[model samples]
Target: MASPRALPTPISATSFFQSKPTAHSLNSSSVSKNLSFWRNGSGLLQLITLGSTRSRSNAVENSSPTQFSSESSQISDVPILSCSEATEKLRTTRETYESKQQYLAMYSSIFGGITTDPAAMVIPMDDHMVHRGHGVFDTAAIMDGYLYELDQHLDRFLGSAAMAKIKLPFDRETMRRILIQTVSASKCRKGSLRYWLSAGPGDFQLSPSGCHKASLYAIVIQDLSPSDNKGIKVITSSVQIKPPQFAVMKSVNYLPNALSKMEAEENDSYAAIWLDEDGYIAEGPNMNVAFVTKEKELLMPRFDKILSGCTAKRVLVLAEGLVKEGKLRGTRVGDLTVEEGKKADEMMLIGSGVLVRPVVQWDDQIIGDGKEGPVTQSLLNLILEDMKSGPATVRVPVPY
Candidate 1:
């Protein structure tokens, strides 16, 4: 009646399915009991055993064979895979799937090198960033072999890390060099670069004091999708927005943002906009929201209670051109009520990902004439132009 130990050797899937005597062979009476359990509820029991192997799991080691029912035996049939077998399985699983974006290169401070293989791009499970969400991240767009606003995004990334109380693994200059080198290695002309700063690997605890050292991780993603300029609809989110302190930092915690986005999709909209605790328009789930009032003044919600988006800041600079040209009266950032936003002549979402996407509808209200406004179209064109041939300060060249 003793519990069986984990298998030392890995077994093939074919041999696993074939009837053979296991290390701890069950007696005829035990087999009869198992067969009876299968007859009673075979489908669910088989599903429970489908991918199980006799692994060295703590629960399996602590289990008492004498106390187990037939169902427990079904769960115990998992094979204990060797390291090589596990690696092979991971490779096979990766190969079986297709993704829209291709990961071109990755740099991990833990391993102290870069890897181009997607299968090898993995982080430690014990990293505080992975388990405890003690991490901060930022992104910069890659266009024509140049990184757009790399310094700006890195500045924000470091600020977030400071707010999270995470120590820097390297100086800002060194981290910037590594990111540029990673993008250069990728040989991707047009894509995006995302990186993270974490509290590093440590024991699974709520606090990060046990972490060994801080960590830096970066990846270059190859994105080839054509830009879409079509207007989209958005709905007001019911999800609670994060507090001002956490909201200002670019942390890895995005549960509410994701839920709000899903809620928008359920309502057949593009994105969800969040209202602050004071019933004023805050921002979108992952982007900044902006409106053009009837007086042609560009207005955006203040960043005091929301993320200060890099793209949104640049848009403010670009909006100055419209004002000089008399296309816009002025630009302002302050609290915007839902009624004010809905009554605006034009609305748009701005972020590194979206880049000046016009909003045609907000809830049941049609923005302006429920069409992409001329000013919105012009702003998108201006951003596109800036990305292609912006000033040296905004564009950092990658020596690929």
Candidate 2:
């Protein structure tokens, strides 16, 4: 059976799914070359000659159908989708939003001015941060009209930006004010605020030297549902944790962290835990882990190679009341190994997203008494109280 010659080349999703096709061409000499191929039994039998692959690619874009001779292969009379025809086949409908109601509100500052316009909530495509990942970000949780630890996370955010060498668009005081105001603008009493500092829009260059200044973005994310403290399982993350320098700074480079979490999910676990090179426990992808020892001591990993978790530190402080009440002997920070961590009386993951989560198991082994220990619940209640009515130092009041 003779293979169909000049059978239309099958297009990839990129070109085939486009809204329209702009041009068409067929390579004749390349099809007349030495290599024979079948376009999946269209009765087309043609050989790609000795021309270079690059030449074939170029010729496919340059030659016309009349160039291919009928003596070897027959061109299909099936008409291909032209610009106007493809418009009817491949166009997709897009949804429209008049305004972001209670869900989200974004503020962008290109020349250092913030706006709540839905049409303008975007960064320049050429920003160094967009092109080269030269940016840093931090988030704060909002609860019951209060911004929890806004200053603490902001301090860390500024510290991370400094580490990334990205300058601040406004002074520290101004930045804080802008954050509170953005939350107020959204009128979201209970939600989260995420902000980013980026090396502002510029040419597609590797260095920030060509950029004029840095940019700050703030957005209000409404998550009205309360926290879910349900216990979750975890696995040992095989992904290598970033080195101390980059790990300490909360930059946008989260590929390793994302992979680690994905690995845990793939294994039917909540999130994966990374081990330091020395084989001691480090931290989770986004949260910190703490263990209550058989002796009633709270042991947390040192902040040497992981991001210092604000919620974890505060939990430690609140747990000191537990120490005075004799519920715990004391709290300490040091390197923790897997064996030491898994054999504790109780284990909990603490972070902004999950205030405190009791861990029932690690890998295939049960943790502590295989239940949510009393101490974990006690500390959780204490933290919740603090969030609601703690001293003014911890909770920043939202104007809205």
TM-score for each candidate, following the candidate numbering: 0.84, 0.78
Error of 2 at 68 (Å): 12
User: What is the C-alpha lDDT profile of model 1 across 84-162, one tens digit per residue?
Assistant: 5666777799888887788999999987888887766788778999999999999999999999999999999999999
Worst 10 residues of 2 by lDDT: 90-99
In model 2, the Cα lDDT at residue 350 comes to 87
Candidate 1: worst-modelled 10 consecutive residues by lDDT: 36-45
Q: What is the number of residue pairs that collide in model 2? A: 11
Pairs that clash in candidate 1: 52-78, 53-78, 53-79, 54-78, 54-79
Q: Write the per-residue lDDT of candidate 2 for residues 144-236, one digit (tens) a residue.
A: 899999999999999999999998888999999988988888878877899999998767789888888898888887765655776779999
Angstrom error at residue 189, model 2: 0.6
Task: Flag regions of model 1 displaced more than 4 Å.
Answer: 1-73
TM-score of 1: 0.84
Q: Which model scores highest in TM-score?
A: 1
